[model samples]
Target: MQLITAHVMSKHLSLSSFSFRAPQDSPEKAIPSRKLPFQTFLSFNPKKPLSLKTHLPIMQISKTLFVFCLISCLSMTSSQEQGATAYEMLEKFNFPRGILPQGVRSYVLNTDGSFEVYLDGECKFGVEGGYSLSYGRKITGKVSFGSLRNLKGVSVKVLFVWMGITEVSTGNGELDFYVGPLSASFPLSNFLDCPQCGCGFNCKDIVSDS
Candidate 1:
């Protein structure tokens, strides 16, 4: 009876102390950690600077593509328009080249008859009508057969106040420039040659045909 009780007590102690542990090479031990490098994608770390090599895939390239297309279209259009000089184009529309001043830096003419003219800077001069004319660096308008309408960036001085030139008409050997309700007519021969800035057509530096 004494031996039986001792053996039972030893068995109870052994059961309580025993713990089941898997082998060192078990499948659970071979699995990787949950906190991996790739899991924290595009995450900023105060101690580490950004690296494009790892985060390039997440960038938005749509805006860059759109801007590139827009610029390419404009360049192609500008190149196509350059086939003809601005003055020559004016002649083709039945308007004299002299209507525009000298030193045109560039111009863009659209298929719909809308055009933009660019100059180095503002140009101001006096015409025979005793009126002072000023031309802005950028001029925009629509040109049609024998007429320039919707004119902007061209102005005239009347009674110490500057008034914009709204329209121009050419026909019957006469040229008319409109300043509000008033219009001035000049002979077509006056515009045979473009006038130079600060020196009407009577430029002293120019040599005569003789």
Candidate 2:
């Protein structure tokens, strides 16, 4: 018959390629397709594993670095007390801008050194052993290094009463002057200059001295 019908159609195409094989992977279906992308990245109460988009950018970068380090430490403490004055902070604590007099007009020290001095009112005068002092348009206390304590608006003039210098200090070279429990000393070249509020320092060298 035509060569036995082409050998039974070449043995039916080699038994359809060994009954079509190919599939193989199996460790229980490849571990649920590799745990389906780690269970869609959990966080649905998986014991609260940090997920407010990971603590909201770490609390917004720690509150923007604590408000930019508190406005750069308050602008470097107001640029180091701005124009610093009070007679250059009483020569930086050693004191003696003639113990303050000549219409100060304004002040305030405080960094625990406490102060306040202002003037242009309530003054008084006379100095040089005849004493007299006075000066209360506001003055206050607490200084250090060479010292000055409790003070409050000045005063002096003993021998005719009116006493309350409260405190002042220095040492060896002298310049004491307290009040209660009495004290006195002087001679730090008797306060360089700066007195006139009602005309003091020897009448500013007695007018026309020629």
Q: Evaluated with lDDT, which candidate comes out highest?
A: 1
| Model 1 Cα lDDT, one tens digit per residue, 1-210 | 011111113433333333334456665543232232441433534235634344343333545556667765654444225588778888888878878888888997765677899988888887886778888999999888898999999998887999999999999999899988999889888887877777756674445632
Off by over 4 Å in 1: 1-82, 205-210
Tell how far residue 119 is off in model 2, in angstroms.
Answer: 29
Q: For candidate 2, lDDT tens digit of each residue in 1-210?
A: 011111123543443223211236533332212211221333323234434344554567678777777765554332125687677777677767887877787776655676777788898887767878898989889788899899988988888999889888887877898998988798877787777866677774677674
lDDT at residue 66 of model 1 (Cα atoms): 60
lDDT (Cα, 0-100) at 140 in candidate 2: 89
Worst 10 residues of 1 by lDDT: 1-10
Clashing pairs in 1: none
lDDT of each: 0.73, 0.69
Can you tell me which runs of candidate 2 are displaced by over 4 Å?
1-52, 55-57, 75-81, 91-95, 98-110, 114-174, 177-189, 193-210
